[model samples]
Target chain A: MRVLCCVKRVPAPGAKINITADGQDVDTAHLGFAMSPHEECAVEEAVQLCERFDGEATVLTLGPPEAEEQLRYAASLGVQKAVLLSTDGSSWDPQRTASAIASAIETLEAADGPFDLILFGNESADSGGYQVGIRAAHALGRPIVNAIKGIEPDLDAGTATAKREIDGGFELYNLPMPAVMGVKEGLNLPRYPTMRGRLASKKIEVSVMQAEADEGGQTRVTLKQPAETVSNTVKLGNGPEAAPAIVDLFEELGLL
Target chain B: MADILVLAETEDGAVVPATLEALTAARQLDGDVHVLLCGDSVDADDAAERLGEYGASTVHVGESDLLNVFGPEAWGQALALAIEEISPDVVLASGTSKGNEVLAMAAARLDLPFVANCTELPSELADDDEVELTRVQWGGSLLEQSQLSAETRIVSIAHHALEAESAGGSAAATETIDMEIDDLYARTQVVGREMAEAGVTLATAPIVFGGGRAVGSAEAFAPLEECASLMGGRVGCSRAVTNNGWRPHRDQVGQTGTRIAPELYVASGISGAIQHWVGAMASKQILAINTDPEANMVVKADYFVEGDLHQVIPAVAEEIKKRKA
Candidate 1:
């Protein structure tokens, strides 16, 4: 019943993002990085599952050396071990990320045993690709569920019932063991690290895996910032009179 | 000619608006557009006629009793069958929760490149006929343009980002296909659904009045809800408000909750986080009512009213009543 949770480092929510001067990627000079919000939920879910099932939880992340901070944070949340697949600040698209994660999982399985469950946030709050979980499942040839809002494990039958949020409501599914799930927020409120936990997390070892070219060259093009529209301010009457003025404002912005 | 396939999402046997929008985009590719509808014994004639109005030249109907419940694996298998039949150049789906899951699995089964929440379409086809796309970044505050090298491009359109246009002609053609429902896979079933008791869904509400941490307490949200109802709308809340237990999770409007496309979005006491902005940015008009003149939403909004929600919301509601009279 061992579980693995994949986490990513991203710009903190609400951070004002700026494009680099070359227009190739986000400007990181003034940005503050933290664990992706949804990934925090994934880590929390993994920790809770391990606590309930009497197994170990391992946290994984693929980024530069700095990403070790996120892994350490997961360790503070009762994760037994941390694995960092370090890259040279290269953007590994979903496929490459999935391959690296699958490779690491295979290596870990060789040492210990296979993980019973793998958890991930629905998508990175930064890239918002929303493809890694499915790609990883494909690469590993396992059952996968995305944007799952709830899960009830049936340990006797070796199956899990999951509730996935749909457009207006939710859909239910039954999947066998050794499946991957991309969790959405509100699954649980992630716990904050205690003083003792923070002190112990600093002693945990982080193993860094070297990236292979084939598994690191998936990103085809770098991202560039979009053209910015100038901000304008207007004030109309508070009630019905404001409706026409709002329409006029939209028309002025060419959004009408 | 390379053709595109669109998985038209439907509920209660009717095509969703986002599906029509996807078809509208597909028609611009200058290739045959096929629409796939999977449901419980759906009428192919009626479904195909509606799909044809959205520029779907060919409508593939896959019906089975198993479709009474939405199973990703079963839907994935059904879509795999359709893809095997059409071998489309590209597959398009909406970025809704169900659409995202089904398409992700379908793309993986076919070993093709996949992208989600695309805001813009490819300007021109590549030499290999691969289509590039532009998608939002940083929680919709920015846009990123990129190209996929795969022959089969899988993309999901951002909901409400595109307009649904009528196909402007008679029904083109229709075909009925039989799909198998494996009883074994039916092990998982949705016994029932408990609809949210909220009067109006956040996504469809014409006016969304949202509360944030500044609202102070759960009891304070009643006035905001009253104001929303007075405006013929519904109530929404920021993540902070939901985190504080002032509102239900379903009422939270943000990246983690529901992305809304309303006619008017009123931010009451909300400071406007990027995640929150992503959900409400597509609203037709934004009105930020915050005491802080420098609130982030004030900058992005079409109009800013500098006042406390406690004072402003009541006044606005009263004015609406008076104006109507």
Candidate 2:
């Protein structure tokens, strides 16, 4: 069955992030970009499903024109097609973002047959709104499940068995076909692209579509740098010789 | 005052602390707070007693077989019915796991905007239907100030953001709402579970001993684990350790992983990346053991021991053992 995976280009996760001077956005002067870890796994899962089911994998992303770079990366790993929902570099509120994506999916399906499975990262690594996938699912009138860690497609039954992580174990959901899922990062270990694959990715043409996002009900006022927390760490000696001191430290905290 | 609706998450026979925290937040949005309690065979009196402590103006209890099993679709449907009848101006819940899913489901059912992981309440300066708020982005690493305008605002309160407090009042009115549970909603019910051993889990651990990429190997975690067990805590790791195949992803503590708030977080070999700091910053006390004193984790920690974790871990464990003996 054909699969569609949604990916987002986010600042590489790590280090303290600085807000831009305007306070309306993140300062990305020294930052690099990568697909969110969760979406990376979603792309990998979509590719794997295509490999097993003898279908094509289409990767879509909503970001600036530079997002084509992420689309190409996905193409390098065997994605058959790449679509860029190109927009202004500014972020969209979840309400508008979800509708824009739903519209794009409908436009794609009008030409191509419907996708059997659509995947989204559980949440964006940057904004982390945790609403777009569910909102899109609702807008498209499809059954959607979120926080999926494991998935088993029942081709015979025309259903998808999705497992979401809970506190102790997992909660399983049997969703009908043409389903949507919000997958987490640990769903799979993404495979690296080979030299030949990278070369093929360079030649793949990216289909760019302008995403006319409506001004939704939500608006970002400004970004605030979180208050810095200072910790005055008392050095408890050094090396293994400090082990006894460490024990004393634990005792002082009553953690013994 | 606007009428606020809170999805009360219950545990055992009482309400979860997070729900109380949600009620605490709801009280601020408006004093007219209503709570929707959904579950099977829920002890209404017990829940109402606890909820009343947090200034719940009304508790709407929805009991049904569909809610007997844990599923967001059915729960959200039930909550939707309650919302329609209660007609509250805003809906609130906690930000992780069940609370996140159920509110998202309800948002979809109603086709409304649902904001998740809110860290701060909005300013009352703009007196209108629209509310100005600040929410967590990058799992608390960054905060985004936003303005949300809707007939009904649905929000999922971020964990550890608001402290749960009681208004110190008696129980308010309790209303039993009629629930219409459909088979379609219950169609995707949970078939099974894999419950972990009782106690000492990362979320509720009193102390947490964590390692990072510098810890070297999976076997290297043995000493840290021993130290954690001795201290009645759990052993956690950074995403780097899981990436290096030295530890499982479940042991990771970061924005993308578990947000841990323990009595103390004793971390070694970790550089205290922003993502990890977001999760570990909630700890009451933090201690870092790293060779580089200038490391991010060391600089942020409340206590430090500059050394190789491989040598320091076992020595500390041995010292604890010796002291106990």
Off by over 4 Å in 2: B11-14, B39-41, B123-127
Q: Please, what is the TM-score per model? A: 0.89, 0.95
Question: What DockQ results do all the predictions give, each relative to the true complex?
Answer: 0.35, 0.65
lDDT of 1 at B207: 79
TM-score of 1: 0.89
Taking every candidate in turn, the Cα RMSD to the unseen true structure, in Å, is 4.1, 2.1
For candidate 1, what's the RMSD? 4.1
DockQ of 1: 0.35
Model 1, span B1-325: residue lDDT tens:
6588999777656777778888888877768889888765456677778788888898887777776556666677678778888878778888776687788777766766677788866645312544457886666777777666666677888766688889785675877568885664464345445355555678888778888889999998887777677666789989888766677777889888888988778888888888888788778888887788788887888787777778776666665555557
**Candidate 1 overall Cα lDDT vs. reference?**
0.76
Candidate 1, superposed: residue stretches over 4 Å from native: A13-15, A213-220, A227-231, A236-256, B39-41, B63-68, B176-192, B229-232, B314-325
Full-model lDDT, candidate 2: 0.84
Candidate 1 lDDT, tens digit per residue, A121-146?
88888888887887777678777778
